[model samples]
Target chain A: MALDQSVSRRRLLQLIGGASVAATAVGTLAACGGGGSGSSSSGGTLKVIGVGDQEAGLRKVLDAYKSSHSGFDFNLSFAPADQVQTALRTQLGGGNAPDVHVVYPGNGSAMSMAQLAKAGLLADLSSQSWTQKIPDGFKGAFQSDGKTYIFSPGSSMLGAIYNKKAFATAGVEPPTTWSELLSVCEKLKAKGIVPIALGAQTPWITQLIPYALVPGTVYAKTPDFDDKMLAGQASFAESGWVDAMNKYLELQKKGFFNDNPNGTTYEQATSMVATGKAAMAVQVSAVLSAFRAASQTPDDLSMFPFPATDVAADNWIPAGVVVGIAVSAKSKKSDQAKSFLDYCGQQENLNTWAEAVSCVPLYGDAKVDPALTLFLPALKANKAVPFMDQRWPNAEVQPTHFAVVQELLGGKTTVDAALKKMDEAYRKKA
Target chain B: MPAVLVYAVVVLYPSIAGAGSAFTDWSGIGNAKTFVGIDNFKQLAHDSQALGALRNTLLLTVAIVVVQNGIGLLLALGVHTGIKSRMALRLVFFAPVVVSPVIVSFLWKFVYNPAPDAGLNAALGAVGLGALRQDWLGNPSLALWSVAFTVIWQCAGYSMVIFLAGLEGVPAELHESAMVDGAGTVARFRHITWPLLAPAVTINVMLSTVGGLTLFTQIIAMTNGGPGYATDTLSTVLYKQAFVFGKFGYSTAVALVLAIFVAAVSFLQIGYLRSRETAA
Candidate 1:
């Protein structure tokens, strides 16, 4: 009887195991089936996904396109910046990306035009008429291996977005030099206003201060710094990056930034500056609308280049091509998506989108946002460089830069160790 | 036979195919992969980030298994009595268990806001314990514990329900006889209740252990393993390797190791706990 009971017990165990496995398998299939439903191209509606920052321009253009051309319908959605790196990338990897989706310019991110185009995941946009009109300096951002893959409105200036009211309260104007910036910050602090609102908790936010600084400290001194780094002739630890990082820390030591920056978020910092609790934040012109919306006095805000050196002439700015859209190679409605992109490239639509986002139109001579007047001279003087990560070989360096900056803000790592970590990340295979 | 076929097609095939990627260098996109036998595993062995994540995972598992289950048992015992409000107490305690982990994490994130005038800090000041205020999720040293505390707060109720079921199964006759005799409540619990509760203890321990070892959603939702990777676990590291760093093969290797480790731990724990149950 004991022998019989043991045999039955073994069989019962097998039965339970098989049932559980079957249930799990069915659940997995249901999940996989559900995920593909959103990307389907049925009934001629083009599926579109964009980052939140692109919504103002992207949605306006899409709406205008729909009104002008009947049957050019689109299903538009926006993902937060961080979610795009994961959710959209997963869709791309799974070969179920939307008909049109956001793609960052240049090569330093997983969802960048170069990376996706190299994977044969993005439709070639080289045949579009506007591809030929891309400025010579901005060609590298739009093209990978001589093929255009993404369409962007224009370059966005990275600088300090300040409240005129806050600056006036402290009796200071936007500083034109590093020493002047320090004096202005001291004045702002004396008036009990935070000089700078650094939101290091948001990973992408941590890189802006460095981006605002590196144009002068690294690129201005060595125009071919990216080329030398690519050739293994230069490193972040040995270059002007050290001075930039030291200046960054020097500002912190002087208590210019808001308290516990690593704990603060981008929205919090934006609110601080908008409410005049803080004087300024190093930010991109693309987000000027967000800052304006957060303030009761939207007209009080304007932007100027964040000074990086004591010499006013050395204060170069970062003006990189803004995040843009690409047609997925796997989309069944590629033609429709391409047409929409082409529509976006028309000078009128380009200017409209650029104006909505407060960026410079890519190829047109249009009136730019008035708040960006201070940085245009630098752009005209060729004192501007593309965002540093745009030239990085791989995605790792950008995230490592973000992490090290947070570490620096948290007092968890020194500049030397932080730069060393970045150097190590830079050496990784792309 | 149909179930077996479905299982093979849905579960076995994809799992085995995915496991094969561990020996290659796939970048999680495209057909560009190279066979690089065990290179990922070798790299993982020396990877400081992965090592640190492992340490975090183990620490979290131990803390959850001990503290979560301990509080659960106490709650179970407290609510098992004939108190007039026992059902209401049980319902209140088990409420969080029914809510989604993502929702719980987000709610707790707001509670841990670092500003002195907001969330937990304000509450601390209200209670005259202002000195206890901290940058809860922002401080590297405190982030992991804060995440752990959230997980515990949300899960202790689950353990309580399981222990409550075990408590219901304990024989009331034995307690009654002991009460009539020279036995007190503590003596009866030590002699009769604790030993009989061994099976419930075993189940709670195993479940909490596995859950803690695989803790991902809370940490990701709260910290994204930030403030310099102080809250990262093996799961988040593997996720970042695949999605963020675009190293799919290395991520798969890490996943396979984590799977094998969890399985081995569950097996050993079940074996030891089952024997203890039988001995009890």
Candidate 2:
């Protein structure tokens, strides 16, 4: 009993000693983590966070800003596209948001404008001199309660990017009607070429074809379709979404896509079209450079609107701002970040930024890239509509669309079944 | 006192706060939350995707635990015998565990590609088993199993080292005596070696159960719980709901369910294994 009591006493002392050490260590760490707030360095350094190719483009813009304003300095960080939203959201929630960040223009995407504005995480940019320069089409995208919060440099069009040389080899013209598109596919198939390169392995790629087609199928006649959806008067299943989805499925039925599109990655799909193994791929303008970079001859590639209807006159292109820059409401460097935004708003600066990302300049007077000249006719004729998802109320709906499209491609679900799933997600009270 | 303070500040506080938030409608942004009073849990009960994810989680856990342990024991047994190449072979088997799970998943993704000329398919074709070639990760039916295979491949070596330690602990004299008494290799292994491995088996099963239940990186890297939620484990579902959808409250509720499940299942397994260890 005496021995056991001594052992117990020793163990208790050891535990107490260990605990005190842990406490001291934790306290030291806490002290180190909580440093001085002396200088307000936030005002001196403009921190910007972006993702994907946007990083390289933004870095160039920052360099230009530095040279022009010799005393200005900035910090920039980049993450993978998939991680950017999560990283930014966590930072904002922790009250350490970057001074400037890349946010999607509308509510449908991750890091959407509306949600951030609702959270009061975004600074009101309505008073900024550049706010007035925003086009009518884009003004509604970044506004909440009639107050602007985001400034986008440009917009991107989603369409069928084809190898011009491959088309010439197959003797098939870019189709203006749905049936004509099928006939072109048949011709391309006979010439031993994949008609369309679909990278369904990347879920976002699954959404692009449907988005590219929806303009002509759903919104050409019903420009108020998204409005009806917001008012709870319409659902995806009851609207022209079924038509767009059916057109998407028809390509699968004809065996026009590459074998095992669900297995093909985005890189593979881009390379397939770029190398002329496939005739075309329905993708966004943002990836045009990626495709070009993979091509032996970048000049051989061009884009055309993906037609969803038989009427050539009714065809429309899907277009939307790819990403917008926003100032964090918590930033002490709001003025400095706004200065960067101000610099971004200049016509020359906007043109440089837009061209780097292969985007259509938001300003009408800005010089357009020669490669984007193909989209000019549609834009000038008012046949290009903003991406349908841009008008959606929440982020969840876009991913739901992606999964449904993947299911449709894989022959796992019907158009109606898939559309019903989308409608269910749309009606989810976010 | 310091330990308690640290625990209270870091682990206990966050856990209690997280549990509290599970009952609210916090969207993980700004301080807007309303107490929904178990509504999130009720939604989880009705959420087909969440239920499906739970089912996948259970299935994946079982598959990984059984397959990983079986392969590990085999490798351990092989290395235990006096083979000239045992050391090198043991090193080879254990190598994969040191590689990151993300890289492992990515490497396996290429190997399991469904294309005719892809790694596994080409190997099958070369072996005249072309009919067995499959869309390993793309097919809904095969995707869960495919990801489970990757998980098993990465960790089987870890399990082997544990079983190896247990095997080393078994008395060589006992095996020699049993052989002298006319015991065959099978009989000796069944009666002596198997019973002696109880502690190692217990440790392995518990570790595997916990790891399998909380699997996220492999699923995310390979499938992203995709091909239309065919492989959505609870962790992936929680991540999507919280991070992707911004339904942090609902996601936390799902996370709470997952936590309860992991704890209950792990407790039951450990109890059963411990009882077996005592009996043996």
Candidate 3:
């Protein structure tokens, strides 16, 4: 009986020791994590998460803010575009989101401003001076229910980032009409250059060509197409999107695109144009820096609006507000985060961020990237539309568009079928 | 009692509560959930994407189970002999089992690069087999098989290790007795080794079955369920629903169904395999 009691006592002591060790370990981890967790204004290091496209501008502003503010500090990290949808959204869902994070400008994406603002996950920036300065046309990108929730530097132009040397080799210039574009492609192809580098394997890349086309094919003809779609008066299948999809297939059928485009990636496509293996890739001006970085002669690369129609007057461009940052509504450092966003809203700071990202400044006559010069006349003439997905009612339509495009590219689906699928996805609940 | 309480709090509670979300229209964030009475499940039944993913999942699982185990058995038999390089071969075969699935997926992705002058195509060209080269992951018909090959490559080693352990446990006395009875190599393997390895086969098959059913990491790292949903499995569909489509409720329903399906399959497989073991 005595031995049993002694053994029991020893076991009790061991349990106590183990519990203590575990408690200490927990304490240590918590203390380590404390540095990154949202904290009060005085000495807190605000955590910031951003997507790769936003890194150049977001990092510049953050570094500037840190240098100027005596007490301000930040821990900044960037996620690739695909991971932002999964990893960062998971963080947001779990309610452990960073104080500041990247949010796409409009409603279509899962990580867009409208969706997050509706979820009550973004802090309101309605009272900020820059919010007041936002143009009426672009307000939808920054606001939800008449309140601004995101701060974007400016709009990114969607067009072809073309290799100047490749064009020179083919003795061609940037095309202004669909026929001219096709003729130019034929010339480039004859010159032994892959006319276009399409990387449909990258999900986001699949949407760019269609986005570049639809601004003219769909929106230019029906200026209120988004409203008509919202009211159920228009659908993808019965609209000009069929023409755009046909043109996309026409390019493929003519062998204008690199071989096995569905197998290639965004990086591969970028390098193809950069190295003169391909003449151009339909891409956003936000990625011009990436194209330039890929090229040995950065000056060899420039942008031109991707022509969608034979009529030059009807070939409008797509210039949507680039991805921006928002203060998390649940952040403990909401004020600090808001202050940083407010700082980002200043005219000079806005220009700095916009210039870094190769986008047009939101409210200023700031000197824009030279590569974007060809797109200015369209922007000036009010012949530009926000990206089609930006006004989509729900997140489902965009991914549907991505899938159907791949299917079209792989000869697995017809243009009619692809548009039908997109229309079905569009009709789903937000 | 404390350990049980801890398990209840840490594992059981979260799982049960998470399962409850399958019945609602919770968008995965915030407190705005509506109890829609299994609407998600009803919708899932009609979801073409989910159905397609189910078909892909079953195909992947079957391929992994049959091919992975077959290759593993062959590898085990080859290396279990009195060869001078047996240990080296064993180490080489099992090396991939220790690496991260994400890393392996990335490596294989490089090998599957679609360029004619790069990766597998280049190697094929070097061997005068250029005509055999094809887009490994981008082609809709080939993508699912490409992913299956990657999973098998990484996991066949794991099966080999398990079979090797079973081989170690097999007694030399049985083999000696069979040989003394004038049994040839094939006869000895059929009557002695194969019967003795039943438990190992059961274990390998069960583990691979579960692994195949829930395969996620490699697919996400490599394909992201692309090229017109050719490579999508149930796991990717649920993930896309919750995070990508903002339909957490539907995602949870998928997770619940997948969990139930896996459990049912495992129980049936274990029962059959256990009976086989007993008979052996």
Per-prediction CA RMSD (Å) = 15.0, 15.5, 14.8
Q: Which portions of model 3 miss their true places by more than 4 Å?
A: A1-42
Model 3 lDDT tens row, A129-180: 6677666566677777777788998878899999999999999999999999
Task: Mark the regions of model 2 whose C-alpha exceeds 4 Å error after superposition.
Answer: A1-45, B126-130
The TM-score values for the models, in the order shown, are 0.93, 0.92, 0.94
- What is the C-alpha local distance difference test score of each model? 0.86, 0.81, 0.87
lDDT of 2 at A161: 89
TM-score of chain B of each: 0.98, 0.98, 0.99
lDDT tens digits, residue span A217-245, model 1: 98777877888888899999998899999
Q: Rank the candidates by DockQ, best first.
A: 3, 1, 2
Model 3 earns a TM-score of 0.94
Give candidate 1's TM-score.
0.93
Winning model by lDDT: 3
Q: What interface RMSD does every candidate have?
A: 1.0, 1.7, 0.7
Better of 1 and 2 by DockQ: 1
User: Which of 1 and 2 is ahead in lDDT?
Assistant: 1
Candidate 2: tens digits of C-alpha lDDT, residues B1-280: 9999999999999999999889998988889999999999999999988888989999999999999999999999999999999999999999999999999999998998777888899999999999998888878778899999999999999999999999999999999999999999999999999999999999999999999999999999998888888889999999888878888898899999999999999899899999999999
